[model samples]
Target: MKLIVQIPCLNEARDIAGVIQAVPRQIEGVDRVEVLVVDDGSSDGTAAVAAEAGADHVVINKKTLGLARTFQKGIATALSLGADIIVNTDGDGQYAGHSIADLVAPIVRGEADIVVGDRKPGDNTDFSASKRTLQRVGSTVVKTLASIDVPDAVSGFRAYSREAAMRTTVFTRFSYTTETLIAAGNSGMVVASVPVDTNAVTRPSRLFNSVRSFVLRQMVTIVRSYIMYRPLRAFMVLGFGMILIGLFPMVRFVYFYFTDGGAGHVQSLVIGGALLVCGYITCLVALLSDVVATNRRLEEEIITILRRMEHDEAARD
Candidate 1:
């Protein structure tokens, strides 16, 4: 089996080489292990450092395409290179490279399609109180929305089997950690998590400017992904909740009409009727969105098939 460890770097020149060199060159069940570094328009000479530090392949973007797109490119490049298994790690070197073998072991053993390296941020002394709380809340939100039990929802260190990598697709430009997990869980892909160690933080987070920004972006990603995968249920709940709320106002208006002359309560009736109409419209939207989501699923399957064919033809050539 061939394993490729792919690092997605963005201006990480100071840490990229160490991350590349830290990757294990051999594993028990793998015949070959190679490092693939994808630079997302780094101003620093991250690409040169990677190549000199023993990266087997280096893919550079002319301009920054953000993390999600860079990760997508790395996965495609690794697949084209005949990687049977793919592991993704941040170029910042915050993740311990020694845990890579443990991360991919589940995939190598055919036990899981994706294996996430759980940093256990809550237990880590390195994490501040606020960071730990945010990690816990974020992970809980992911687990609830995706219906998957992942301890670390935002971990960059992960492993994917060939099939899983081929099937994976990321629509969000912010990050792939949460969206991919939601997709895998909703699509019934096997996902497992293993405890892993982390290195000391050498640099500030480049993902977002502040904690508030991170929370907002992650919330948007989670909600968008949840709606994308489960549109019917999501809209249905909202529609019904609106209807339920409208009912309360309508009932109040009726009681006033029967007991009294219902003078000022005409406004209640208007508000309730408007809400009811909105609820009905939302339900209709739900139906349409579900149809679109179904089409998206079919398109995803077609894309996977085409990718397999293209890769196979390339292998033959």
Candidate 2:
């Protein structure tokens, strides 16, 4: 078995070397281990530093494509390199390298397709009170959306088996941590989480400018992922909720009209009628979206088959 640890870097020149070197060269069940550094248009010579630090492969992007795109690029490169297992960690040296073996153990033992390293951000002293609270709330939202129990849903340290890597596809431009979990859960891929150690914060997050911004982006990601996987259910609930709320005003208008001999209560009738129209339109949209989602699933199946064929040809070559 060969394990490829991929680090996605963006101007992390100072810490990339240590992160690469920190990875263990020998794993109990893996025959070989290698490091792959993907430079996200870093102007700080991150790619060069990774090469000097003994990274087996370095893939450089021409321009910055955000974390989500960079992560997908790294995964593709790792798969092309014939990696039997892929472990993703940040280039900032935040995740403990020694914990990598523990992180990949579930995949190595065939117990899970993907294993996430739970940093228990709520208890981490390095984070502020607000950040800790955000982590807890965000994780709860992700668990519900993904239908998976991951304590640290935004953790960057994670391991994926070869099959898992081949089947995974990410579309969000923000971050992969949440979207991937939701996708895996929806796809019925086995996911497990293990406690892992974290180093002190080396730098502030570049993903968002403020707590509000982070929360907004994460919520967008969560909602989009949930809608993608469960559009019918999501829209059904929304349509039904709107319809239920519309009924209250309509019923009130009817009661007031009957009691007051039907004078000057037309406003409520108009408002409720508009709401009902909107709710009905939303339900129609849900049906159309369900049809689109079915087409997407069929396309995905075709893509998966093509991917397997490509991988088989690569192996033969």
Candidate 3:
């Protein structure tokens, strides 16, 4: 099987060469291995450095498109280049390149559609205590939403089979790590995490400048992706909660009215009625949202089929 290791770079000229060179040129059960560098509109000569480092392919974005888009572009390019498997790593070399073999083993053996590299809990000495705590919480939240248990939900080191890669699409611009896992789980792709070693910290993350910002952004991403994938369920829970809350006040109002012959509880009646109306509206919105979510899923399936057919035709050509 042919495997392509893709690195998304943005102003990473200093570390790109080392990341490229560290990629294993040969692995058991893989006939060929190649490197693809995606330059996210880097002004620091990252593309030139990648080429100089002997990257098999380099695709440059005209403007900075963020990590999600850059990763999507890299996947598309890898598919076009006849890559049977795609492995994504960072351009900063934070992940040990030598561990890529372990990452891809499950995919090569048909045991998993996607393999995530687990950096091991408490292993990142560079991360502050607060950062590590946040990481744990974020990973737990992602796992609950995605229905997949992954120790390192934010790890950039991952491997995807061609089928998984073809069926996946990244919608959020903030990060691909979390969204991809949720998408894979929603699309019924088998995901497995294996322990892998990480290289020492190379540079600070470009995704977020501070821990506060990172937490805020990641929380937004998780909420947005959850809504996108499970809108019906989300809306249903919200609607039900609102209804229950409204019912409590309404019940109290009714009890007061019955016991006192409708005396001195006019305000309670008004408040309860208002809440009931709001709850009913929310439930109506949930129904409409469910229909839209179904349509969206159908559209996605059609697009996936068309894309697979196109890829097959291209391969034949």
Candidate 4:
């Protein structure tokens, strides 16, 4: 089994070398280990630094793709290179490279399709109180949505089995951490998390400028992912609520109309009628959305099959 540890770097020249060197040269479960550096339009010569540090492969992106896209690209490149297992870590060396063995242990043992590294609380003492609280709250929300106990949902250090890698897809460009967990759960992949240590802060997070902004983007991503994965349930709840709300006013309007001879309740009748129409329309939209979601699942399955076939062909060559 070959393991490919990939790091997505954007102007990470300073820390890339140490990160690469810290990776284990020998592990019990794997036949070969290689490092892949994905340079995401880094003008700081990150690719050159990685190459000089003895990285096995370096994939360069001409334009700066966000972290999500860079991550996806690295996964694709790793797949093409016949990686049996893929481990992803930050290019800034925030995650302790030595802990990668523990991260991939579940995969090697066939216990999990994906394994996420859970950073212990206070691992990064530099994190603000609000940021820490948000991390906890966001992780709890992800656990609820994904139906899995992922304590560190935002941790970038993760490992994926070949099958899991092929089966996963990321829709949101904001971040892949939460979306991948949710997707894996929805797709019935075995997901697990292991406690791992992290290094000191090497640099500030480029993903978000402020806590409020991060929270806003994460909220959008979570809602979008929930809708994508469980459109029927989401729409059903929304449509049902709207129907109940519409019914309340309509019931009131009817009660008043019959009791008062429909004299001063014309506005109530109009408002109730409009709401009822909207409620029914919302239900109709739910059905359509469910159909589209089903099609999307089918498409993803097809893509997974194609990926496997391509990999098989490459192996034969």
TM-score: which candidate is best? 1
- Local accuracy of candidate 3 as per-residue lDDT tens digits, 1-317: 89999999899999999999999999999999999999999999999989999999999999999999999999988887888999999999888999999999999999999999988756678788887888788889988998898888988899999989898899889889888898888878899999998887867788999999998888888888898888878877887777777787778878988898768777777787777777788778888987888898899889888878887778667
- Local distance difference test, per candidate? 0.92, 0.91, 0.89, 0.89
lDDT for 265 in candidate 3 is: 73
lDDT for 194 in candidate 3 is 97
Instruction: Provide the TM-score for each candidate, comma-separated.
Output: 0.98, 0.97, 0.96, 0.97
Which has the higher lDDT value, candidate number 2 or candidate number 4? 2
- 1 against 3, candidate with superior lDDT: 1
Colliding residue pairs in candidate 4: none
In candidate 1, list every pair of residues with a backbone clash: none
Q: Report the C-alpha displacement of residue 241, candidate 2, in angstroms.
A: 1.2
Q: Candidate 2 — worst ten consecutive residues by lDDT sum?
A: 308-317
Residue-by-residue lDDT tens digits, candidate 1, 150-192: 8888998999999999899999999999999999999889999
Segments in model 4 whose C-alpha atoms lie over 4 Å from true places: 122-124
Measured with C-alpha atoms, the lDDT of residue 57 in candidate 1 is 93
Per-residue CA lDDT of candidate 4, range 165-194, in tens?
999777788889988988888888889999
Global Cα lDDT for candidate 3: 0.89
lDDT of 2 by residue, 1-317 (tens): 99999999899999999999899999899999999999999999999999999999999999999999999999888887888999999999999999999999999999999999999988899999999998888888878887889898899999999889988888989999999999899889999999999999978988889999988988999899899988988998898888888888899899998899657888878888888888898898889999999998888878878877777677567
